[model samples]
Target: MVQSALWDFLRGQFTRLPYPETTFTDQVVIVTGSNVGLGFEAAKHCTRLNAAKVILAVRNLDKGNAAKRAIEEATGRRGGVVEVWPLDLSSYESVKAFAQRAMRLPRLDVLLENAGIAGPPYRLAEDNESTITVNVVSTFLLGLLLLPKLRETGQRYNNTPRLPHLVIVSSGVHYFTKLPEQSAPEGKILATLNDKATANMGDRYNVSKLLEVLFTRELAARSPLPSQAGNARGKGGVIINYLNPGLCHSELARNAGLGLKFMKFLLARSTEVGSRTLVHAASAGEETHGQYLSDCKVSRVSPLVSNDTEKHGGKLHTRIWDEIVRKLEAIQPGIMQNL
Candidate 1:
């Protein structure tokens, strides 16, 4: 397995695959953290595919506008094909505000939750660890908050035979995480993660991603969408999935040190190549709901995440989801009602 993983990692370095020829024609798409790196490339692809409105949700409007202009210049489809919206993943208020604006739109066909932080100095946001807050908490907050709009779009287009999509950006590094034992304790996981001495900040990002995968699975199971079991084409309501971009050459790791930078320079896939996975996941059908995707296909997850009929059952997955919902509810009262 180690050798196979190494081979896959090496192949990712040379991957130059183009975005698939899927047209978003008239669809409204939103990409978070789109000011630079993979998010920016993905937004560019969305415009080139003809999305009517591609919102670049970022923390800084200035950088967002610059990215929008660059994408417009590259795609040559100007005149508001791309719009900048303010979103700070570390702020609950910001997420709520962004979702409010999104609900005002007549249609929301796709939402790409691409914004994330890799490694940063220990910090807290909204009473939780910074990485967990931004990567897992606020990410889901905005996603769940926007569900109403996505569901509305699905209903409006139900007869048209299409479902709105929600795509979460995850990482294969999740497989490397051995979740903190305290992370399993009720009402204590976030607090435990916040404790700098006990928390392995190096692996905290990976743990947050593992939480994302578990959340995706639970969310799909709880979704009103019909199951993809018997039907191959998949019954549609709102399709949700997480994807691994594989060691992409992006600014996410800019702060990591010279050694890591040298390795990335030698082996990382370009942001454009990595963004193709995001575009593919966003355009995929319901069959991919709750699955981890790599290289544009439904890929196997780590044994730690694999579903088993007996051993431990689904308790671990459920525990993580319950904790997440509890934390989110504390941030926004009655937020569970939205889900």
Candidate 2:
């Protein structure tokens, strides 16, 4: 966690992730925020690999349709193998609606939670800060809502070569963030983030990534990843994992300071190159369950989330998980059953 920022950035720039070649033939996949950047590129990859249906879940239908057309033309495959669907993570109702629609899918093989935002000027979405609401809360809301579907797909597709995956697009920025907001009083972690007086926009994105890492680990712990032996006893089936795509050439940092923009131009990978890891993580097998990935390989996390220690001091891990579960349960009663 104490590595030089310059060294880390330079390393990420030079070490490339190989383009994923995994075939997703006939699999149903969803990539949220697929209208542009990494999400768009990842969805394109899925289409190229022959996924039966690639759902482009976006906030804007126009952009989503445009992306769908572009992908269809690029792949020279038509007839709706790639479909656009409305998914505005900023609203709870929108996320719920999206989940309801997904439930009708014959099967869902992968869900890449790629939508997120950085904050500077304050804004609220639903019951929390816009970044927290969209990035952490709604992201998980959709995931939790569709957990039963993912589990069901595992059983339904048991004979197939495909595996179910729920991959979240987290970031290595989490390693640099201390997540000071977490120091707030018990049960006030998210409340403190919503407090404009206490909210630190300077590091909101990083903090959100840290939360994603924490939440993914906790969920995997509670539900347990499907085992390689098969979903025996229904103990494990879907592979739930998160990854750090590193600094990529994308619009995700559009709100950052000018200096940061210059740094990104010099240090970031291409949008296509960065998204390779997304495809890789999605197709990776049982070993990746609850693990953090970087550059297409399992990687280390900051000590705050390091698995070497049980629960990273125990209390911080459990307290944060408790707070999130409470909020999620409030949003969707009996939601934990899906996990």
lDDT of residue 269 for candidate 2: 84
Q: For model 2, where is the 10-residue window of minimal lDDT?
A: 227-236
| Cα displacement (Å) at residue 69, model 2 | 0.8
- Tell me the lDDT of model 1 at 302: 67
lDDT, candidate 2, 18-86, per-residue tens: 878889987999999999999999999999999999999999999999999999989887998999999
Give each model a TM-score: 0.93, 0.95
After superposition, candidate 1 runs with Cα above 4 Å error: 1-4, 15-18, 159-161, 182-184, 227-236, 307-310
lDDT of 2 at 216: 89
Report model 2's TM-score to 2 decimal places: 0.95
Q: Against the unseen true structure, what C-alpha lDDT does each candidate score?
A: 0.85, 0.87
| Least well predicted 10-residue stretch by lDDT in candidate 1 | 227-236
Error of 1 at 53 (Å): 0.1
